[model samples]
Target: MEEPIRILYVINALEVGGTEGQLAELISGIEKERFSPYVCCLRTIKDKSSYSLDCPIIALGVSRLMSLQTLIGMLSLVRYLNHNRIAIVQTFFIEGTILGVVAAKLAKSVSAIVVSKRDLGFMLTKRVIWQLKLIYHFADRFLANSKNVKDYLIKKEGVNRGRIDVIYNGIDIEALEKKMQEVSGADIRSREGIPEHVSIVGICANLNRKVKRVDLFLMAAAIVCKYLKDVFFVIIGEGCLKKSLLDLSEHLKIDLKTRFVGSQVNPIPFIRMFSVGVISSDSEGFSNSIMEYMGCGVPVVATDVGGNRELVEDGVTGLLVPCGDAEKMAEAIQVFLDQPAFRKKAGEEGKKVLLERFAKNKMIRDHEFYYASLTKEKRMAFKKKRGKFSA
Candidate 1:
């Protein structure tokens, strides 16, 4: 029998977010013959149902912060690694990253623990800094979602630059395009009560202060309404700040055009109906929504932050503007809306970038290769050290 590759993946929770979605894509895409995968969730599932995946998923129910329950959950994860003999341990987000790496060491099943950094400055903090440093000391490697994130880790936390590798979050282009093409956005708009003739501006954000600036999205929409007629704004995803955003939009006097089209079974339906997808985020690592919009053949007018520039080539693919500059954001979106030819050109160009750079298959293959390399290196070193000790 051939030796199967066993991978233990730890994530905070497999909720509806970019990092979680990326994990789903990778696990589904991996060649199961060469690799066997298992997952450990740091917290309980909100839905109270087992998640369906190609690999088995374990939930530790680590609900509290710095508690005995959390420690016990970490130990349970450690025991699983020991029992399964997990070779390479990979983690996502901050809290999981800290616990997973340390537990992997305790289990003695982890040769190389890889941490995927999602955001730079905001994601890291002084509270977790010591834990991160401890993980850094014991872990074999650190993998960043992008070069920008690697720069952040090195500059902010003083992580060893040589140990860090940059791997972009992989996007599934064919699936995204097919999903978009099969959608009936016309009916979706009708059901959402948005008229067909109105200019629709879409935002894929949960109203929040730290990440997606729902406030900025509303403000930009207010300015866009001044010049454009029959404009309607669509905000997707649900968050704590949803009600506050609606109130502010009403205060701006564009409440008529504002529609709080909350979370959907399929956001692609709403995403395709719009003339353009609006991103007014103050921070991002790599934007899945921005790429998803482009994949749907819709141009984006996003704030110039994180990997937004890597996806949106200002004026070519779609316009990029300074963060919080509502006037410039409105100007760019208006320009795309005014010129039909420009809209066509920008959308097509953006799609080209997604196909070439963000293909999901490429992302999967890179991880497969990385896993092989790390495992192979560990085995070789193990044999060498054993031989020396015996002699």
Candidate 2:
């Protein structure tokens, strides 16, 4: 039997964000018979217990990007790649992409280098863009989570369209459904002191980035409060902007109606309680939050930016509003709040779409095919080069 091809996934951290969650799911679900998976985190793992993976995880303990530690980490990565004869090096986030791509190139043994693009370059600066462009040619492939992101790469970064592949993010429907079955929304609400009769409008997003535009979610909640007094707003996830966002909620006079529940390991219960789930991001690659919402059979109100339009079928599965328009978002949310039948129908449609289009099995299969094809191409080219040398 042929040995499993070894693949290394490099990322900044193994925390509870969209990228980290997707990486965890992918590595966990990937068929071990065909591919062996490993993870290398650029930063130290603060809580090792948070991630329960079957593969080995190596942390470089890197603190600063331009320090001796980072230099040492890069060298260690190259040594590790060569020592393991890594066939594929897949990287996530900016730091991991910059470091992993270059290190994999230096390793010489690495057959393929894949860089993942999950966002619309909303946080990228001019210098960062230049830095990324410098190493773009070194990568074998660019994996985009959404078609919108692929377009952004081709248009903004001037990447060759042929070099990019779009694979939508997937969720483990069975696992999520099982958890939803185990945890009741009423129990969660009771624990949080929320009334059973009050409608819950919730959002699950990190408060660390302004791109998420959680502030808009709050503003819209304030608007929803004027007409629906029985509505309660729930904000899931934690970040640096939590304090400021708390102040903003208070300033909007929706503080009493809002609950800022910090970073949940499993937000399925809170999601289960939501009458409507919202994504107020100024931009997104593809929304894991929207998928989670749909998996729980909850309707969504999202900004029509990035891959949101792809996930949300406007007026069918959910409503799509203009980005940065809090009033428009509030109006969409109100539509769901007023009509329970339409909301339920939309939620059902969302679940059907999610099951059909974004299953974890489909994602894993797509990746396996992509990786196997790339590895084969590399081997063929190498064999041709060896024949030339012998001749």
Candidate 3:
């Protein structure tokens, strides 16, 4: 029997965010009999216990980008890849993509290099784009989480259409269902001092980045408050911009009805409390928050942006509005609030769409097939080269 292929996944950190959570879920759910998974972090992991993985995780202890430690870490990564005969090196985020691709190219035994693109490059600068373009030549394949991202790579970055594969982020429905069963929405509302009868419009996103456009959520919430007195707005997830967002909420006079429940390890309960789920991001690769909202049977009101349209069925499952248009967003939210039956039906349809299209098993199977095919092609190319030499 052939030995299982060894694939090393590299990332910036194991933080409690969409990218990290997706990585954890993929590694944990991947078929161990066919692929042996390992993880590498460019920096030290702060909370190792948060992820449940049996495979080894190596931290290179990189303190800064321009330091000698980063150089040493890169060399160490190459050595590890060569010594372990890594079949594939898969990288996430910018730092991981640049460093991992370079190291994988240097490693003699590495067969393939994959770069995961999860966002729309809203934060990338000209210098960073040039750097990424230089490194793109060494990578064997690119994994985009959405067609919107794939199109961006081809049209914006000059990548060939054949080189990119669109793999939508998957949700572990079983685990999500289990979490929903375990967590009580009533308990969470009580703890947060939210009244039982009030309608809740909520958003789950980090406030650190301006690209999330959380200000739009607050503005829309304030608009909703104008017509409805029995509604509350909730923001889940915390970052440096918390103070500024709070000030904005206060200025809008919606602070009295808003709850900023900081970062949550398990936000399912909070999601359960939402009468409507909202995503006000200026861009998205694919939103895990939208999936969570659908999984919890809560209808979504999202900006019509990257990958969002793919997940939301406009008038059927959820409503889509223009990015940065708070009034339009508020209008959509109001539509859901006014018609409970419509909201409930939309939520149900969203969940059905999620189950049919974005289940965990489907994602795992797709990845397994992709990895196996790449490695097989690599082996065939090597054999053909050897045959030519012999002839």
Candidate 4:
């Protein structure tokens, strides 16, 4: 049997964030016949013992973000990549992209390095922007989860368009469906005190008011509840804004119609129960939640910002409203509430989009093919150079 291409996935941490969760899914879904995967984390603040990973997840144990120990951690990463004979080093998010690219460049045995840009610098600091501007020059290729992120890198950061690949985020639809079956949707709705006939619109996001705009969701929900008596809103996930979001709901006098589920480890069941999946973010990269919602056969209503437009076609799979416009959002939700047949058709179409365009297997195949192609190009170039030297 031929040896599989060895690939190493590097990230800042293995916590419960978008990038970390996506990394886990990618490693699990990659074609085992063609690729052997390994994971390395700059830090492991969360419980690493809990996540079920196929490959070994090694932690470098760096305590600080930018310190002498961090430099040592990068050196250690270089040594590990060389020792493992890793054909490709793929780094995710900001810190990993910075540290991992530098380590790959410095490593003797490794040359191919890919960095994933998952966001549009929405939360970037000046120092981080400066570091990325310097470090990204050393990377071989960049992968953006959405065209929005890809364009942002080109127009804002001045990255070469040719060097960046736009690969939409994929979801494990089968796995999601299985998880949904494991938990009864009726049980969940009952626990939340949502009646079977009532329409449930939900937003599954971190309760970050500034970026995710949970407050905007509440404002929209208040508008929605006033006219649509049978509608309820659920905000899934936990963040610092939970208290303030609840307070805002009370202030708007829609507290009776709003329920904060607080961080759910398994949000798929809740998503499956949604009459409409909503994204009220001021900014986003390609949203995994939107994909999950569509996979569960739920229509989406997302803000027309970042990659939301890429995932949702207006009036097709779901609706799109202007960012921070609660009135517009409420108007969209009301359309779904008033027309059940139309909502069901949109949900079906959304599921079809997820299956055809953003399946987990498609993502793994694209990644495997891209990685193999990069390594082959590098090897062929090296061979040509050797032939020239011999002549």
Candidate 3 contains a number of clashing pairs equal to 0
Residue 273 in candidate 3, Cα distance off native in Å: 1.7
lDDT per residue, candidate 2, 1-391, as tens digits?
8899999999999876788878888888899999999999999999877778889899999876889999999999999999888999999988999999999999978989999999999989989999999989899899999999999999998799999999889999999988776777777887888898999999999889989999999999998899889999999989999999999999999999899989987899889889999999999999999999999999999999999999999999999999999999999999999999999999999999999999898888899998999999998999999999999
Model 1 TM-score (2 dp)? 0.94
| Model 4 accuracy (lDDT, Cα) | 0.87
- By TM-score, how accurate is candidate 3? 0.98
**Tens digit per residue, CA lDDT, model 1, 1-391:** 6677899889989887778888888888898988899888898877633345788888888876589988898888888998888888998877788888889889876677888787755755686776677677877888888777788889877789998987788777766657775668777777778887887888887554447887888888888888888778988888789888879989999888888888765688688777899898888778888988888888999999887887789988889999888888889888988987998898889888888887888888888999998889888999999999999
Tens-place lDDT per residue, model 4, 1-391, is 8788888888877778787777788888888888899988888547965467899778887767679989888888889989988878888877778788888888887758888898888888887788888988898899999999999999977789999998777888878888897789788878888888888899999875479998888999888887878888999989888888889999999898888998878888888889989999989988988998899889889999999899998999999999989999999988888899999999999999989999988887888788888989898999999999999
Model 1, residue pairs in steric clash: 171-360
- The order by descending TM-score is 3, 2, 4, 1
Candidate 1 lDDT score at position 94? 77
Clashes in model 2: which pairs?
A: none
What ranges in model 2 sit over 4 Å off? 387-391
In model 3, which runs have C-alpha deviations exceeding 4 angstroms?
A: none
Candidate 3, residues 1-391: lDDT per residue as tens digits? 7899999999988877888888888888888988999999999988888787779899999866678998899999999998888989999999998889999999998999999998889989989899999999999999999999999999877788898998888999889988886768788889888899999999999889888999999999999899999999999989999999999999999888999999987888889778999999999989999999999889999999999999999999999999999999999999999999999999999999999999888888899999999999999999999999999
At residue 300, what lDDT does model 1 achieve? Answer: 92
lDDT of 3: 0.92
C-alpha TM-score for every candidate = 0.94, 0.97, 0.98, 0.96
Q: How far is candidate 1 from the true structure (C-alpha RMSD, Å)?
A: 1.9
